[model samples]
Target: MAQGPPPPSTPVELLTNKGIIEEPFVNKFWGPALFGTFTFIGVCVSNWFTRRPVFAGIQKHIILSGTAAVIGKFVDDYRAGYLAERDAVLRHYIELHPADFPPFERKKFADVLEPWVPIR
Candidate 1:
């Protein structure tokens, strides 16, 4: 009996195959987890600064990436004409049911408030 090729004996492979972990965890929640943790820390620090005002000017920086992602998606969708098409559908519905969507008469609050002025 000639020796066959050695079986795959990597420690990680053995542990995984032996049910230590069926599959490794691919962490997709790191961003949200880190954000929440940092936010909690910021709140704690703010509490610590009770004697003086806590001026964290970089608050927006925390959410800037997510905000930009949303804005980018919106712009891309608009450029693709999806937004225009959706708006057109909404307009068509409003036109179809004019009673439900009353047309706006362009008049200022001043016109309503000043009865002394001549009604033009």
Candidate 2:
């Protein structure tokens, strides 16, 4: 009897249903859980060496991490708002004065404005 078609040659084509099922769970939960556990252990050990109580060290870690997270969120929001305003202004200007931008420049702006395009 003839054999089935050759197995997938490339890594991308070789993925199985099990791999797909595990990928998201590993990415969304396992990675962060591992990192947080390691960080907590490191902080506790460092505090112990410094002669600080374990609970107090944990409290400090929580407070500092919370403050940092809030500050990071505010910064992210500000950056997003700034980028939106800038893109709007650029698009409006392009619309008002199409002659000012050549086709190449227009393409550049389009790429830059695209949300999926990474900033260099």
Candidate 3:
């Protein structure tokens, strides 16, 4: 009998199926996962340095930028459904820690952040 094409046999093999590669990588949480992890680590290091009197040059901009990056990842993942579970957890935490978030104030960030974050 003639041999048919070999069947996909690995976890990665499923990616070869149609509509896999073409789909958004965020749906798999790869992009947000990497960005959030790196941003969090950098934020912690920057905050540590901020406490020292020697590194006066390391402005609070690091924390601001790092937070923006993390939020950006959350928005990206939420829109991608990668954060569906994550969002629930965050929402729960935020609910418990009401002081962490600011009142909903619209800002120019919506111009960029909105595009990345879908209305859901």
| Winning candidate number (TM-score) | 2
Question: TM-score for every candidate vs. truth?
Answer: 0.27, 0.42, 0.27
For model 2, the superposed segments whose C-alpha errors exceed 4 Å read 1-56, 104-120
Model 1 lDDT tens row, 20-92: 3332353334444555556656654765677534444445444654555455555555554775576567756
* CA-RMSD of model 1: 27.4
lDDT of each: 0.51, 0.56, 0.57
| Each model's Cα RMSD | 27.4, 15.7, 19.8
In angstroms, the error of model 2 at 112 is: 22
Candidate 3 C-alpha lDDT tens digits along 1-120? 977455554323322344433556555556555665676566667667778443344445456556766776677756756645555666666667667664554446657564466679
Clashes (candidate 2): 0
Across 42-103, the per-residue lDDT of candidate 2 in tens digits comes to 67777888898765656767665555555555665676579767766766666677576544
Screening candidate 3 with a backbone cut-off below 3 angstroms (N, C-alpha, C), the clashing residue pairs are none
**Span of ten consecutive residues with least summed lDDT in model 1:** 10-19
Worst 10 residues of 2 by lDDT: 9-18
Residue pairs with colliding backbones in model 1 are none
